[model samples]
Target: MEPRGVVLVAAGGMDGRGAMSVLYIYPGKMRGNGLDLVARQHLQALSEAGVKVECLARGAVSMPGITCRFLRHTPANALSFLPAAYYYGAQSRFFGAWACRLLDPGRHRLVVAFEGAAGRVFRRARASGVATALICPMGHVGASGSRAELAWPAIGEERLEEEYAAADRILVRSRRAAETFIQRGVREERMVVVPGGVDEEAFHPAQVRTPGPFRLLFCGRLSERKGIRQVVAAWKEAALSPEQAELWLAGSEPNEMKAWLDAACGAGVVRLGFVNDVASVMRQCDAQILLSEAEGMPKSLVEGACSGLATITTSEAGFPVQDGVTGWTVRREDSGGTARVIRQMADDVEAVRRMGASARQEALRHYTWAAFRKAFREGLLPLRQSAD
Candidate 1:
């Protein structure tokens, strides 16, 4: 049976579009191999679901079912801005402005905008009798402009408000994220929770970690927001020699923390900036940690769980990792608490391994890409069709 409606997805990055007559618009260059593999995975999944996706990217994506539409002008960092918060909002707005020129609103029955980037596109889609869905797809948006600025730099208060007011439904990835939006005055009814998922084929447990030092990984950008400094502090407090325990830091190092990071690196911490093989890193490590101040079900945590590695995290880091079952969640910002947890793991390798196996099972049962796609596709259906 055919699905009810055709949708248009406008994202500054690769987001989602439905099956059959669905068009996906991207603001930047897309390659077969690049940093944005998550976006590529999404595109591939939608195509496999039989969506006729007209993809707007700079380069070629080798997907068999997708139709590539090369934008004459790629999304550029050609503008200057202040407070660093307006830069992304401005760029996203520009992308929508340029993209709207190419859109024929007569075609789509539904439209989805990602991270306030497609407010203009949503407006146009709504004008053509299409329902609009807005999604920030982040940890949280604060009541104050500065808080939103701190959380999502590319989306400013104005653009965020525009998106909030324009759409029929607002898609959030977690309950915490929905709460944040509600606090900002958006009704609970308008918010729909659709968490992100991992591609199991790429991230499933492929190899058992070899016997070595008690290895722990810290992925994602090395920034204060991700609790990099807190992890470093707790690791130092764990008081284990290099032979007994070691920490590996992946992703880009923050410029502001270079001095601290350099000193830590000299003390035997390995720094791998922007690792390409995240799954390999996860599979090889005994554990991982993400003690973020704010988060919306991080993909790294899911990947780690899928790779059969117990993740040491915090409640604020959100994503249902069962404490003492799949993994452990320490007190937020408590270096002592984190250190104690790490110390216990260091002593009992068997317990860590057991938790890792359980983590993989739980993730496999709940956090698959298939589930993400099913939820997203259902959201595309009209209210009547959905109720039916």
Candidate 2:
């Protein structure tokens, strides 16, 4: 039996003629925010490039020339108590199983899935001789150093390895992310590095710098995984007076980190909890910092660069922060190194401006969605050929 809510949005073919369609599975809602926003862009990119896509999601998007199918609900609602990794893994596998029952090899040539959610679907597609692509939005689990302490248990390392093995192509967000897969024995040829994109117009530099202290922004979840503690420690160690420099944290403060964050608040950290206009915040700030221990290409850093703010990051953050050009790339958890970088940025505003200019140029050249769409279309060429 066919699943409900399967809308065949248009009668047109790929390029207005018959062509094998691609199956895109996202094991969650398409809510147009965060990961959902990224997924939405991927769908639009493929559709705009004249590829017919049949997307299976928990919720659907309204787009011309595409098929959108959605399940009424997912097990995730009941399993909310589980750890995030475990919850998502279970959801992915469940969605994969349901999608498999509806799989039509004659209609769909390839299957594209995100992360560990659709490993089951990858294996099934391979068995049916349909090529499969896996989009790993974050670094490989095996390479997730300190993050493994929390992530590895629910999302076991072996699960991702199996997914990687079954996938004909693996799309990663950075060269750093690709290296992690290579280290885990995935072939280099199978990898396609698609750095996450930013909206260049929406995040452009302020024509005039806002008048204030030398403000540095940290604009994501204030969690241990984000290395927020290290960022605060570094800011305190820099010893810049509150009037001279201020550290602004612009994301949700998790309950677990409240005590630490409260202490940091007294030492020049200003909580701008859950900002909706991050670009506007970026425009007002002198620099952006993210010292995450592991990531795919971080969207905040990319957007920061696009917004013409110098970025301070760790290499593991998966953003290609050209040391001293775009911003500083400090070692993860190295509070002393981060402190030195912070002090330098505070003392030398002119150099920071130069870095911000360079960063924006780099982002416009390489990190816009236009660049991502072109690269994505090219990456699909070989798969399309094989499917034909």
Candidate 3:
């Protein structure tokens, strides 16, 4: 993991006499499968690469060699009554302003930051002549679809544009994400497609599904934009009974969709609700499905694939499924196709098992955390020399 060019130093050791030191700002907790996980992975990559790192985040994550500064906690439910977008935008702006004050060009060679909260940091870093890399985990803000399609809100495309204009490099999660940015006038050379990764050990291939009903798993927030309603529609079309099959959903159930999902629960839809160890749940299931309308490369898809579950996803969801080999890539609007795939898995268990095996092999080869670390180190650390 030591990618050459950066050095880890002690506290207050910034005599402006180091190899390359970085100030990483995420502005969110370092725990979920969303951007939080992305931030944690980047920090891990930077640390393993022997890069000097200082992290600013909403929640504290203790890593042996990195300096982590936890910001004052502001729970999202604090503003539960308002629209989700406002709370996220306000949080990003607040964190960005706070993080901007901590930037000392003499100490930090490069500032690695996430979008929505990097505008001020980028501006400050540029003014101070420090290098800047913006991590756009969710990709282009202007991409068409519901705002909730990605993990976070767009955070105002204009604000993101300001950040983009100042960033020396923009790191995205997938080729599709990079394409969206290119379509929106972002120079291809300035953007790096650093796709997401899976923890191979934690999400390893399942040896066998738990005995009983053939289960279909959906892991994410229960929302309309996530195509939950469509999932239910497809399940209805398949018309499997509890004895024959079951649909397992693992995520927070929002109030808006609670009533609808509650009704579905009676008809073989089991809500495991907010699971922490997703691997355990995936191990018990026969297959996974996510028909998202838009995404930057969902970790769930990679995790599922790594867990040896054939996926039913959309091209827009950004995981390159090998069509009948690894999984089925369905249209966002094609519930019938999804239903057919579901029926296929139930009717042909051996075929589903073969698909899952292929998926795990593909994931292990391309989407492991080690691979992500390599890509991150290679794509961004060279800026260290320029900064030096």
Q: Pick the candidate with the highest TM-score.
A: 2
**Candidate 1 residues 190-290, lDDT tens each?**
88876668778888765655778888889888988888889989988888788888888988976888888887654647788899889888877888888
Candidate 1 wrong stretches, greater than 4 Å: 1-23, 32-35, 41-68, 75-77, 80-90, 102-105, 143-154, 206-208, 264-268, 383-388
Q: Per-candidate RMSD vs. true structure? A: 6.3, 2.9, 5.5
Best by lDDT: 2
What's model 2's TM-score?
Answer: 0.92
In the range 202-312, model 3's lDDT, one tens digit per residue, is: 997666557988889999988765778888889888888888889999989898899888777567888899999899989998889888877788788899999999889
Q: Kindly indicate the candidate among 1 and 3 with the higher TM-score.
A: 3
lDDT of 2 at 262: 77
Candidate 3 residues lying further than 4 Å off, grouped into runs, are 1-20, 31-34, 59-65, 73-84, 144-154, 264-266
Cα lDDT tens digits for candidate 2, 1-388: 6554444444343242234478888977888577787888888888787777778787777665567777746655567678786677677776777778766788788888886666677877888888888888866547655334545325566676788889888998888888888887788999998888888989999999889889999989998778898888888889999888999999999988898787676656889999999899999988999988878878888999999899999888899988889898898778888999999999988899899999999999999988887777777757866976
- Give the poorly placed runs of model 2, Cα more than 4 Å off: 3-20, 81-83, 143-155
The TM-score-based order of candidates, best leading, equals: 2, 3, 1
Q: What's the ranking of the predictions by lDDT, best on top?
A: 2, 3, 1
